[model samples]
Target: MIDPVIERPRLTRYARGGGCACKIPPGELEQLVAQVSNRVGPAVDPVAPLLVGLDGGGDDAAVVELDEQRALVTTADFFSPVVDDPYDWGRIAAANALSDVYAMGGRPLTAVNLLGWPRESLPMELAAEVLAGGASVAHSAGCHVAGGHSVDDAEPKYGMSVVGLVDPHRMLRADAAKPGLPLTLTKPLGIGVLNTMHKATGVVFAEAVDTMATLNRDASAAAVATGVRAATDVTGFGLLGHLHKLARASEVTAVIDRSAVPFLDDARAAAEDGHVSGGSRRNLEWVTPHVDFGGTGELDRLLLADAQTSGGLLVVGELPGYPIIGETTGFSGHSIIIR
Candidate 1:
C-alpha cells in the first residue's frame, strides 16, 4: 500500500490578509455591512473616558483624560510572514504599528511585542531575528520595548503594541477631511500586487518590497513637517478603499486623478496580466458603487484597489508644494478626471 503519510496534504498557517491591509471585496462587503447595520445618527458611546477608540476614527487604540492635560494614544498591529527573511518581516510589522501613532499626529514612546510561531516547524533563532528587526525600528522611533505576548502556532507572526502621546488639539482623525482637501499619497502603491506575485511565484519588484519593508519614520516626519490635517496609512484595503472609509465617515466623496498617482511601473503590467491578490480584487468590488472612473484604463482602476502591506501615508489637506491629485467633496459617490 502507498504511504498515506507521504500523501498527506501540506498545511499552511497563514492568511491572505497580511497586517492592516485585509482585502474585503467591495461589492459583497457592502451587502454584509448593510445586513448587520448600525443606527444611523450621531455617535453616542457609553464609554466616556475613551476619547478616541473606534468612534473617533483614530488609528490604533487611543485614550484620553488618563491625565488631565495629556491624552494617551496606543495601537497594536501584527501579521504572518510576508517574506522569508525573519528580520525584514519583523521590521515591517513594527513599522506598521508605529504608523498608527504618526497618523494620529503622535510620537511613539513605548511598545510591547506580539509574537506567534510554529514551535516545531520554525526555529526560535529565526523568531529572535524577527524581533530584532522590529526592535530596530521601534528604537529609531524613540520607543522602548516594555513587554509582549507570544504563542506557538503553525506559522510565524510578529508585531508590536505601540504607546504614544498626542496633543488633544492636534490629533488627526481619518474622518476629518474637508471638501476641497487635497489627497496626496506618500509611498507608491502596488505592494499588494508585487507581494501577491511573490507568494504565487516568488517574484517581486525590489523597490516595492523595500518600500513595504521600510518604516514610515521619514515619510511621517516629512508629512508632519508639511502640516497635514487628516491622514491614514494604506494597508489591506488598498488606497481607494481606505479613502472611501474617510469619505463615508466624513459624509463626503473622493475624486482621484488616475494619471497623477504614483505607482511602481511593472506593477500595472502584473495587475493587467491578472496577477492581483485576492484582497486587491475584493477592494475593487467594495468601492464599485461609490467609485466612479472617467474612462480610466482597466489596469488603472485595478490599481486603485491593489492591497498593500505597511504602505505609505495617504494625506489629505492643503500642504504647499504637495500637488492636488484628488479631492473630497460633500457628495455621495466617487468621481475622477479622464484626462
Candidate 2:
C-alpha cells in the first residue's frame, strides 16, 4: 500500500524551473540587493559588538558578536519542484536550507518555513505535506520549525529560515583555505543537468530521486568531523563559480584533477543531448573567464559547473591521499585550473 501520509505530485507536466532554476538570476539579483531602498542603521561595534557575522566567510548569515562566547547563525533557502513527489520536495528543500548552518559548524535550534503555493490550483493539503516534510528534516537536525509565512503564487515553492548556535571560534567560513590544502567534494555532480533532462523526458531514476532528496547532512557532518575550514554548497553558481568565490576570498588558486571529480550516471548522455538548463549554461559562461580546463571533455566541464538547487557541499581542506586531486596555491593567475 502506498504511504497515505505523502501524496504523489502530478508529474505529467514537468516544470521549466526545477531546483535552483527557480532562483532569481544573478544580474537581476545583484540589482535587487543594490536597490534595498531603506538606509540601514549603523553596524554594531567592530572591536567588540559580538563580531560574529563580520568575518563573512560564506556563513549562513552574518553572525553579530553577541559576546565573547556564543554567536547566532541564520540561513534561508527555498526552491520549486525538483521531484514529482511532494514529500521528497519538502525534504530536499529542508536539507538545502539547513546546510548553511552546518557549513558554518553550527547546530540548528529552530527554523521557520518560507512557503509559496498556488492553493487554489492544487490541493490545499499538498502544502501541508510540504510543511510536514520540512518538519521531518528539522526534527532530524535536532531543531523545530516553529512558524513561517506563506503567499499565494502560481508556482509551488518551499524551504526554511534556520537559526543555529555556534562557538565563535568554530564558525567555519569559506575564506580560510590556504595554499596546498586539498579540495574535495562530498557529493557527486550533475544534479542540475540530470534534473533538467528529467523534466525534458520524464526520465528520473529511482536512484536519482534517492540521491537528490538525500540530505547534505552526511557531507556537512564530514566537514565538521574533518575540521575542514572552508566550504560552500554547490548551488546555482555551479562548482567553478563557488570555487571562484572561495579562491577570491582566500586569495588562493584551486587546481582540480578533473578526472578525480565525481559525476552522476544520468548526466553523461543528457548534457550531450543539450537537455541542459539555462542556469547551467549561464553558470558555465559566468565562470569561464576564471576557469581553465585542460582538455577535459566539454560534457565533463558542463557537469562540473552545472547549477544545482539543493546541491552538495564542496570542501577545501587538508589533503586526504585517497581523494587528492589538486590543491590551493598562491594565485596562479587563474581562479581554477582542471588538469
Highest lDDT scorer: 2
After TM-score superposition, the amount by which residue 317's alpha carbon in candidate 1 deviates from its true location, in angstroms, is: 1.9
Which residue window of length 10 is worst by lDDT in model 2? 50-59
Model 1 steric clash pairs: 21-235, 21-236, 22-236, 25-282, 26-285, 26-286, 27-285, 27-286
- Compared with the true structure, all predictions reach lDDT values of 0.71, 0.73
Q: Write the per-residue lDDT of candidate 2 for residues 157-189, one digit (tens) a residue.
A: 788999887777756677877888888776677
Look at candidate 2 and give me any clashing residue pairs.
50-65, 50-66, 51-65, 52-65, 53-63, 57-174
lDDT of 2 at 162: 90
Candidate 1 regions exceeding 4 Å error are: 1-48, 56-61, 66-69, 318-324, 332-339
Model 2 scores a TM of: 0.88
How much does each candidate deviate from the true structure in C-alpha RMSD? 5.3, 3.8
